[model samples]
Structures are given as C-alpha cells and as structure tokens.
Target chain A: MTVTPHELLAQMASTFRHEIGPAVDEPFAKTQAFMAAVILSKLAGQLQAAEADAQAAGDERRAVVAALRARLGSACPARLGDALTDLGHDGSDAAWSRLVGSLYAERDGLGADEFDALLGVVRSALRARLDRALAYAS
Target chain B: MTDAAAPVETRIAGYLAGKLGADDLRLRDVQRIAVGWSHETWLLDASWTADGVQHERGFCVRRDPGNALLREMSDLGVQFDVLRALEATPVPTPRAYFFEPGVDVLGAPFLVMEKVAGVCPSPWGSDGRRFYEAAAGRGVLPGSFTDALVAIHNVDWRAAGLDFLGVPALGTDFAAREIAKWRSLIDATGIQPDPVLTDLICWLEANVPSTDRLVLVHGAYRTGNLLIDDDRVSAVLDWETEVIGDPMYDVAYVLSELNRERTELLSNIVERDAFRRRYEQGTGIEIDDDACRYYQLLYAMRSAAFWMSATGLFASGRNTDLRLARTAWSIPVVLDNAARALGY
Candidate 1:
C-alpha cells in the first residue's frame, strides 16, 4: 500500500528483463522477451492500483492533516502551515515526512502538551498506513 | 585474477598451504554456509603435513563480499583480533587464526578461524522452535544459554584489549554514539525516510539513557546467533555487531519478542525469570529494565536502518540477490513495531 508494492513489481519486472530474457538462447526470443517485460510492467503500473484504495488513503491523510492543523490552532507557526499546504498539494509521502520533521523542529515553541497532541495525529496516520503495509509484509 | 575465478576452494587451499608451512595441503567439505546476512562463511577441513606430522583442522573462512548489509561496520581483521583476545576468557568462541586482507589469496578479504563444533538452529523457523522446546524441557540448555550471556558480559574488556572497538564516554555518550552509528547507515542508504521512522529516531535521540556499566556487548545475543551442542551453548556466532558498550543492549536483544516465535520461553529456550536470576548472579550486575526499554527502542531504529540498507543495496544494483529486495517489505513491518513500542 505504501512504497513496497510498486517497488516490488518494478524489481520483479527488472529481474525478468535483465536475467530471464538474457538467458534465452535465441537472440530474437531474448529481444522479444525483453520487449514483452517492459510493456507488461508499464501496463501493470497503471492497472494494479485500485481507485478505491487511493480514495480511502486520501481520506485518511486529509483527516490526519486536518486534526493536526486544528490542534495547532490559528496562531500555529508558518512552517507547519506551509508543510500542510505542500502535503495537500503534492499528496506525497515525502510531504508527510517533512510535516513530521517540521513538527519535531518546532516542538520547543509548541511546548510539551501541544507537541504530544500533534504527535498523536502523526501516530494515528502511521498506524493506518501500517495496517495497509501488513498486507505486503510477511 | 586467478583467485577471482570459478574455483575459490583451490585458492583457499593454496593460501592455507603457505600459512601452515605444508608442502601438500588440501581442503575438504568446502561448503558455503549462510551464517549471517553480512559475511560469506565457508566451513571446511584443512588437512596437510608440516614438519613430517599430518594434521586435520576444521576452519571457518568469513569473506566480506563488499556489499554486505553491515559492510560499513563489520571488520574481519577486528573480528580476528577480538577472537584472539577472547581466547583467555570463559566466553566460548572460534579460535582466531590467519586474517588475509588482500584479494590475492582469496576472491575477497577473508579470515580463517578454528571452526567450533555446533549447529545454529534458526529460532525463527518451526523446526528450530521444536528443537529449542525439547532442549528447554530437558532444562540444561536454558541455564547454559543464560550462563553464556553472563560470561560475555563478565569479560573484562579493558584487560582483554577490546578498547580498539572505540569505547563511548560514560553517561549518554554510549547511547548517543549508537544512535549516530545506525543513523549514519540510514543516511548512507538512498531509501525514503519514513516519517514513522523519523519520529522513532527523534524519540530515541531525545531520550538517551546513561550507562553505569560498560562491558563487551554482543549486540545480537539470542538462540539463532548462538551455536548449540550437547544442550549447551558451544559458541556464540555472528560477531559482526559486537561492540564495547553497556551490556543491556545485548540483554535487550534477548528480551525482545522478535527472537521468540509464538512462544512463552524467551529466545524460544530460556525462561525470563531464570535467565534474570542466573544472569544477575553470574555477572553481579542487576538488569536495568529502564535501560533495556530505551535500548529496545534503539533496536527498532536499527532494524529500520538494516532493512533500508538491504533494500538500498538491491535498488542500487550493488547486490542483485532477491532476498535483499525482499527486505523492502520489512521497513513498514518494523515501523509498525516502533509505533507499537511508542504506544502510538
């Protein structure tokens, strides 16, 4: 659900392209196998992910960000406000990670209770992501 | 480049011949055994004649493939020295021998040591679980396991000249240095920094514990890392992560549920209470639960770093092993653990 599945599929496709296709005795068959691998990978990337998963994940991310911002109040630091903006705009995991870093960096100004409250938001989001991750994990 | 080619056994034999001062030397049972994730370990018997006396000795050759998970930390030469230092101690280990740094003799930098006789059963596997269960039922192995850890902690690292391991200053320096070590590994890898991991690292850094005692910590002290024979710990293996730090780091490892698979027995062998009693009695050092807790959290960060490094190695094409690629899944799994540990 996170980065694992896509990376796994890419690695598998690479193994097929680099090792499996190269092992073919006939040059024509090897070239064809390599071509098929590349085409199949491109197809799998767009087709593998369900629309339902993205929508559910987006809802969770939005809820986590909203709760965090609400806890920060209107007088929250500009850095945190901008981080949430980048997170919503880009919708990238890196954005979430940066928000986390920003929170820790601003912890001293936020004080103990506020910092803990904000951390709780990230923790809940992490657990939700972990629930999806367990599907790929052994 | 003769050593780099197909038959590595011949090269190893020729190298051993010169070292042993033997006119005719041969290697038997030269089979590679996957001892740990980092090093290429081969168990073999070297037979030869020196001074008109024939002899055969079991030797384990550990070679650094250069792309190992802990390649940045594990040193074969240092390991050889550590083994040599431990020869006078009660701790059971493979006797240190020749350590060759150059690739002229072997395909890679390899160290040959006296291979202690024992079988290391994987505590993570079902069959291995059954083996430990039976051994625990017999009741001696559990005590032996505890005693082995006790002996390791009891080692006078200063007297033994283990200070080359870079001792951290008293107090928070030990914990801080450890966090830096694992953090550096995470930084070196091109893996994405998961926020959960970032939070965990932040927590670990904010709460570095002070140590009262500094002893030789095995870093990974558990059933799988220990060699068992005759229901006793014949030797402790996997010295790659060994360090001169608080012994609680190793104790935290044994206390971890990661070593036990669906079992009540700690490390699938020793009972926690008995282990504590024997360990405390043997070492005259009380097990600090607080320190253990902090170290456990540090372990979570280290685990993430390890998996990230493994996946990074595969991703960078440094190593093409599918197993390394498979570890990409462990990043989330370990973060799941770290979050749970943090009560998230």
Candidate 2:
C-alpha cells in the first residue's frame, strides 16, 4: 500500500513529460520540464537517504566543534561551535542553515591555517558519518 | 519553428555579404543543426557575385540562446575574435569571417565562420573504437593527446598579440581560484541540494594540491569536443573555456577520459603515461602527480556541477533542449566518480 520514493519519482517524471511538457510552447520551457523530471528522479534517491545522513553528520559536526573548542579554550569562537551544537540537538532546517552559514563565515574570517585545520576536522567527521549512514542503510 | 526562412541565418548571411562587399547575397540551405551545448547553430550555403564572378561557400553561423550557462562569456564576438587571432597560430581553429555582437542582426549576437569539414567525436555514438580510430587515422589526435595539449601550452600568448584576451596569470593558488569559481557558479544557480556533489566539492577544496608548472588550460578538453582526422588532431574545437592557468588541468582531463579507450587502440593513440612522457619530452615541462590528481578530481567535480546547473536551467524552463535535459542524468555519475577520486 505504501508508495516508495522510486515509484513517486517515476510517476512525477511521467506526469511532467506527458501532462506538462507538451503544454509548454517555448523551446526553453519544454527543456525545463524534462530537466525537472530528471532532477526529481535524482532527488528521490537522495530523499531516501539524506535525512538519516544529515542527522549523523550533525552529530559528528558537533563533536568536532566541541573537540576544537576544548583544544582552543576561550580563544575558539563560541558562536560557530554553539550554532553547530544547537543544530545537532534540534535537527531543524533553520539550525542546519545556520550551522552551514556559521562554518562558511568562520572560514572567511580565520586564516588559511586555522580555517584548514577546522575544515579538515569537519571533513573527516562528515566522511565518517556518511560511511556510517551508508553502512546502516545497506 | 517556422520553415520559411531561418531569419537568423538570413541576417547572418546579409551581414557577411556586407562585410565581403558583395551584392546579391543569399543564404540558402539554412538547415538548423544540433552542435555544442549552448548555441543555435545553422549550416548555410552562401553565394554571391564578386567582380562578375560567382562564388558559393558553405559556412556555419552560431547565435546565442536566450539563456546559456556561459552567459557571462556569451559574447560570440569575443569568441569569433579569438578564432580570428588564433588563425595565425599553430592552434587549428576555424577562420572567423564576421562577428556581429549586436541584436539587430539575428535577435541575438551571432558570428559567421568558415566551417572546416571533419568528424567531431560524438558523445552519443555507441562505437568508441570507430571514433578513436577515425580520430587517430585523420591525424586529428596527436601521437599522444597530451602532446597536442603541450603544443597548445607552448603557444607564445604574447606573440599571438592576444594581450587583449586578458588571460589570467598562473598562480600557485590557481587550483583554489578554480574551485571557488565553480562553487560560486553552483551557488548562483541555486539548484536544489545535491549532497554527493556538495561532499565532493568540500573534499576537493580541502585537498588543494600544489602546481608543478603553468600553461594554458583548455577548460574543456575531452574526446567528444575535438574534431579528428587521419591519425592527427586537425583542429581543436570549442575554445570557450580557454584560460591561462595550470597546464595539468587539461592533462588530467585528457588522461582521465582517454585512459580507458587507449587499451583497445592498435597504435596506443593516447596512453596516460606515454602522453605525459611525450608532453614532458616535447615541452621540457615536468609533470606533477599530486597536481594532476587534484585537477582530475576538480575536472570531474566541475563537470558535474556544470551539468547540474544545466539541468537546473532546463528544469526551470529557462532552456529547453531535450539533449541538455537528458544529459543532466549523467552529472550524478560524474559526481560519484569525483567523490571516489577525492577519496570521499
């Protein structure tokens, strides 16, 4: 009885092609209808996995920031770490946006050495989380 | 969509006729042909009487679509000018005849160029061997593709009198700049989140490699983009992505695509090691492994992002080409490869 993501995507793709594509008058518009269908298909695959992946990534990101904060003591910017920590707990869309934005902001503010150190930690954490998520899903 | 007369083609022929100082200029056989990703191309049969002499010629005219991925660099006149200037150089490019940047001529900017006859490796073709064989046999692909690339690198940009092109100076941080540029483009397009692509981009930025040498980077150098003939590269087509930066960008691109197909070829048209060795031998330029790996991953990621953007454009109803829409499906695969290359 349950409609899978794949099924939903297939339905959407067919609907877009048959119902929407033919109705489009402009060449560019017709192209968009087709692309939308393709993107929807891609998004379907991501949707099946992204939520769990993001949750795991959120946990790891928070852990990395906590460790960096501990090492740097008071000198470490509390704002970015705090934002990541909040995102880890609430797991809200706004929190995720803020977390990503803070990381980017910190990257811009900090020197390459400091930025890379932080980024390396973030990348390592994300990769570990992604691996875990993939393992769990499989 | 009208069949009467492709207005754009007629206008282009009219402009070319004026430039050639001829009367009774007619653009016949203006058949719309599909080529390249961004432009509407037409092959026209042009004829006129000059000094009581009748001359007919076949040429191509390309006009900009309303929306293009390379919109910032959509000045067809600039591309035409580059071709015009490069005609004197060893780099084989079509001879541009007329470049009209104004909208008055064709409802958009267009250019007319002498259409060189050759088989461009079609990406959609099934027979890879035939394509490579034809490319190698026609001398369209050099003994090593890398050698041809180095030849492009060896071109004295100064002697070409192309200072006006404002080729970016190569820097140690060239890879970083490139990463930032593509990232910005992805961000600007505001396409939906692609987690795999995002992860790949993050990985690439984190692992920026050192540059060993500086040379002209053909932003897009792959098998499908080149026109080949009789075992030699007749002409290198599509210079829209040409820039002055790390030479490894082009090297990495060619190596990644040609490596798989090289095994099947009789003469080893483009083996990765042989290509690199030949390039270094010919140009006295050393190849850097770390830089090559970085740029190879970068090329994959950049290509994926570009395709994503194209898909976005098509999805948003801004550009409608069935091929463009279909090609979007391949971006994720490329992104997956990029992620693997980056050890993600």
Candidate 3:
C-alpha cells in the first residue's frame, strides 16, 4: 500500500509503452502491449478523480430525487416516492441507479410537459455524471 | 490430447482431402491473419492433384473465438449460408467452400472460403485514408464501393433463401427489432445501469421508423469492411451482421462520421452526392433522410452496446484480451455520442 495503486499503474504503463512495447516484434502483440499501457494509464487517471466524481454524482442524484419527490407531492407513486425518501444524505450509487431506472420507466405515464421538465433536470445531471465518468475516456 | 498435439495445418489438409476427394492434398502458407475482432482468421494456400491435374488455391478460414466481441450475434454457419446463397447473385463476396460445425478439427466452428485477393484499408488510420484517397482520385474504387452496397440492397434475399434471417412483419418492425436486439445484449452485460443509454434506448423505441421495403442490410457496411482489388470492390467482407432489413440502414452507416477520419467524403472514399446518386440508381430506392437519421442514432446505441459488452467481458474475466480491456474506455465515449444524437 506504500506505492499507491495509481502510482504503480503509472510506472507499469510507462515501462510497457517505452520499454516492452518497442521491443515486441509481432504487429498484433506490439499493439496489444501498447493498448495495455493505454488502459493502465487511463485507469491511473480515473483513480485520481474517481472518488470526487462519485461524490459529486451522488450529491446530484440526491438533490434531483428530493426535488422530484417534492414536485410530485401526493401524486408521486408510493414505490418510487418511498425509494426516494429512503435515500440518505450520502446515497449509495446503487439506490440512485435504481431510482433513475424507475423514473425512466414511469416517464411515459406522466403528462407531456411534466415528463419533459423532469427529463430535462435528470438529463442535465446525467450529462454531468457521464462527463466525469468519461473525463479521460478516448 | 493426441488431436490437440497434431498441427492445425495437418487437420486442415485432411479436411480438404475429404471435401475435394483429391490425392496428395497439401496446405501451404498457413499463416494467421489478425484483422477481424470476432473470428480467428487464417490465410492458407491449398493444393491438390486430381486425375494427374495440379490445382492450387488460396483460402481464408474464419473460426469462432468462443467469446468474440459479437459472440451472441455472430453465426459462422449463417455467414457460410449467406456466402453460398450469394454465389449466384451479382454481389461481390468470398466463395465459401465448407462450414465445419464440429470443434475436433480446429478447436471451434469455422468456415472455409476462397481468399479474395485484395486489401481492406482501415477507415480511421492515416495509411488507410491515404490508400482510399489515392483510389478515390482514380475514381474506380469509389464507384465500386457504391456498386457493391447497391448489389447488396438489390439482392432478393427471400428468393435467395435468406428469409431464415427473420423478416420483420410491418412498419417499424425492423427498427423495433433492431433496438430490442441491442437492448438485450446490453442487458446481458450486467453492467451498472447507464441513464444516458437507458434514455437513448427508450427514445429509439418510441420513435421507431416505418419501413415499407425490406432488403439485405449489411449492418456494418463501411470502408474497412470492403475488400479492394485493382481499384474496385473485389468483395464485401465481414458478413456476420448481415440481416433482412431496411437498406437505408447500410446507407446510414456510410453517412456516419464514425467511419471517416477528417474526411468530407462518405466512408472517406466516395463523394457524398455521387454515392447517393449511384446507390439510388442501382437499387431504385430513394435515400430517405429522416429514416437514415433515426438509423444513425440506432447505430450509435448499437455501438454503445458493443463497447459495454466488450468491457463487461473483460471486467468479468470472460476474456483476457487486452483489446477487450481497452474497450472499457470507449463505453462512456460512445454513450456520450448517443446522448448528443438524442439531443441531450
């Protein structure tokens, strides 16, 4: 644990890309080594921001779910409302994912204007989460 | 154990002997070709003496990799059937010889076909772009590219016994079926839920397009999938995704920006106007822009499914290939593209 996983991966990736990859003769094998290096490097980058991204995403999900619950008032489906109410300040990723799926499933049943409004907020947050997830993605 | 020890060249020779019924059957130039993502392709030269006549031919064998990128969707037997059925048609394709169902010979199911002489330029690579550019200036390759696609669209699949690829019943059935097909694949990955991907899927389902005409759709019709010889499309390779669906599906692929590298030409070869004109003239089906837009979005979703399955396979230890691991990075990238297409 002394050498952090990201640091170790970064060193290994550098070795692979600079040392092992150049010496590999076979075209396919060389490409494989290079790709392995790329994956390791990207994983290292992801590790740097992963925790912060997950926290930001969790906060956004909680905020959006809370707002949706308040917007629906008594009209909210008990199944979804109960799930939303159960989310703590720091909601786990799984609960948020399930709530998102439920929202998508129930979107068609809502009035067109309501559906559009809910979708707008959810999609904006979804975009932020995706952007963070793909920050280092090729 | 004994069979595993025996060289694949030896078994291939024996298999060819049985198929050709010739004496002194031999295989030469037995080399593996690393190109396709789904199949283990091998290039070999086969020779045999029949009635004191010497005959030699080049062949390519595509063997299933057991857990290929599109394992659930690809069928080597179906590809062989398609090639065999296309032999009488005008469409350019490799001449398929035999399909081996048993794994004893080569460790997996394989299809043997005549190795069409040609080079397939990679669509995104600089060298490939240069090759296509040089060929485009010559003008023959671009025309051949369109002509080959036209031939596929013009093929009477029902008459050619390709109806086994289920025919969609009514309007929007093709789009709906395609969406469902990729959705099932995404579901199979068991990856964490992606709201963007889920939204894209729902939107595709709700906006399914109506299609009155059905033709053979080469699902991944693009620059890299075509074989070029003498500045002409010698063969349309990669038959794994062929289906009986809308022709515009193929057209939309040519139009997609994913297949080009900083090039304005469709597929980085044919001029956009010329391709549309020639395709319409040959197939007699007008290019529908609205349907094409929808199919392009479907293509984006399909691409996301592919990357998700790829990454999931690597993450779950179903495959150890570095290429599969690399695909994990593309999942979010492709999903973002789909979100943009959905106007997110």
What DockQ would candidate 1 receive versus the native complex? 0.36
The 10-residue segment with the lowest total lDDT in model 1 chain B: B1-10
Sort all candidates by TM-score, best to worst.
Answer: 3, 1, 2
- DockQ of each candidate's interface versus the true one? 0.36, 0.15, 0.61
Runs in model 3 lying further than 4 Å from the true structure? A79-101
Cα lDDT, model 3, residue A74: 85
Candidate 3 chain B — worst ten consecutive residues by lDDT sum? Answer: B1-10
TM-score of chain B of each: 0.97, 0.85, 0.97
Q: What's the distance in Å from true for residue B90, model 1?
A: 1.2
Q: Cα lDDT of all candidates, in order?
A: 0.84, 0.66, 0.85
Could you give the CAPRI-style class of model 1?
acceptable
Collision count of model 2: 20
Candidate 1 local Cα displacement, residue B101, angstroms: 0.8
Q: Residue-wise lDDT of candidate 2 within B1-344, one digit each (tens)?
A: 12235556556766777777788888777778664367778877888888899988888788887677665544687778778778887776778888777676777777788777666655434576566765555654656465567668887767776556654544547777788778877776666535455656656666677665556566777666665655556667777777667777876766665234535432234545666678888778777777777787887767776777776777787876655666555665675566556555
Indicate the residue-level lDDT of B304 in model 1. 92
